[model samples]
Target: MSRIGKRPVELPSGVSASMSGQTIEVKGPKGTQTFTATDDVTIAIDDSSVTVSPRGKSKRARQQWGMTRTIVANLVHGVQNTFKKELEIQGVGYRAQVQGNVLKLNLGLSHDVEFPIPEGITITAAKPTELTVEGHDLQQVGQVASNIRDWRRPEPYKGKGIRYKGEYIFQKEGKKK
Candidate 1:
């Protein structure tokens, strides 16, 4: 049995949930988000909680049960509060800044990289070397942070690049005679 799937997702006072077919929508003070589950699971919405159950004893159904439950929980939480990701640049001249709908990055590359911020997401530069990505949807916020980290990932030799706040990069020793 899946212990995670057994737990119901509780809706806060300002949050509401509705389901249509395979899709579940959660609305709260921050915003609304929706998730579509596979046919292997059945979703139920109670007065203050949501539950997901497997349709059968098959392996696929069992897999979907836990995943669907987690998705529903994420939707409920995301609608109530905004998700955020932080990044730190650790190079000599590397920096990041948000201008309108685009993020300008200077990662010691030949030229600056201009990344256009997608809808429903906001990127902010608290300092020249610190960036914050925020969105109501957890998936989108994480994706944006990953994409930003992809550019000039931390090097094993010098550990100089953009990285998550607490990420650890293993350093390699320099060549010696």
Candidate 2:
């Protein structure tokens, strides 16, 4: 039995959810999101709560049961609030700036890197070295942050590059003279 799957997802005030076949759509003040569960799980909505259960006593059904329940819960929360990820640029010349729909990054590379912001995602650079990625979809927000970090991951020697805020880099000693 899956402990997480057994718990029903409760809808907060001003949020509404509807089901069409295997798809569940949730609408809230922030935005509207939909999810379609596989046949291995059954989805039901009742009294401002959503529940998911396995279709049969099979391994795949049991595996999807918990996953489907969590997906529904994420959809509900996503529509009600936005997700955010913060990034920090380290090193002497490393920095970032947002201009219109483009995020300009300077990571000591040969030239500045320009990343085009996608729809539904907002990238803000309050300071030259600080960046915040916000969006209604949790996955998109996280993915954008990761992609930006991949451009110049933090190195252990000088810890120079773009990295998630509060991330730790194991320092390595330099060679002796």
Best by TM-score: 1
Q: Which ten residues in a row have the lowest lDDT in candidate 2?
A: 74-83
Report every candidate's CA lDDT: 0.92, 0.93
Q: In model 2, which regions exceed 4 Å deviation?
A: none
Quick one: RMSD of model 1?
0.8
Model 2, 125-152: lDDT tens digits are 9999999999988878999999999999
- 142 Cα displacement, candidate 2 (Å): 0.8
lDDT of 1 by residue, 60-177 (tens): 9999999889888888888878889999999999998888999999999999999999999999999999999998888899999999999989999999999999999999999999
What TM-score goes with each of the models? 0.97, 0.95
Worst 10 residues of 1 by lDDT: 71-80
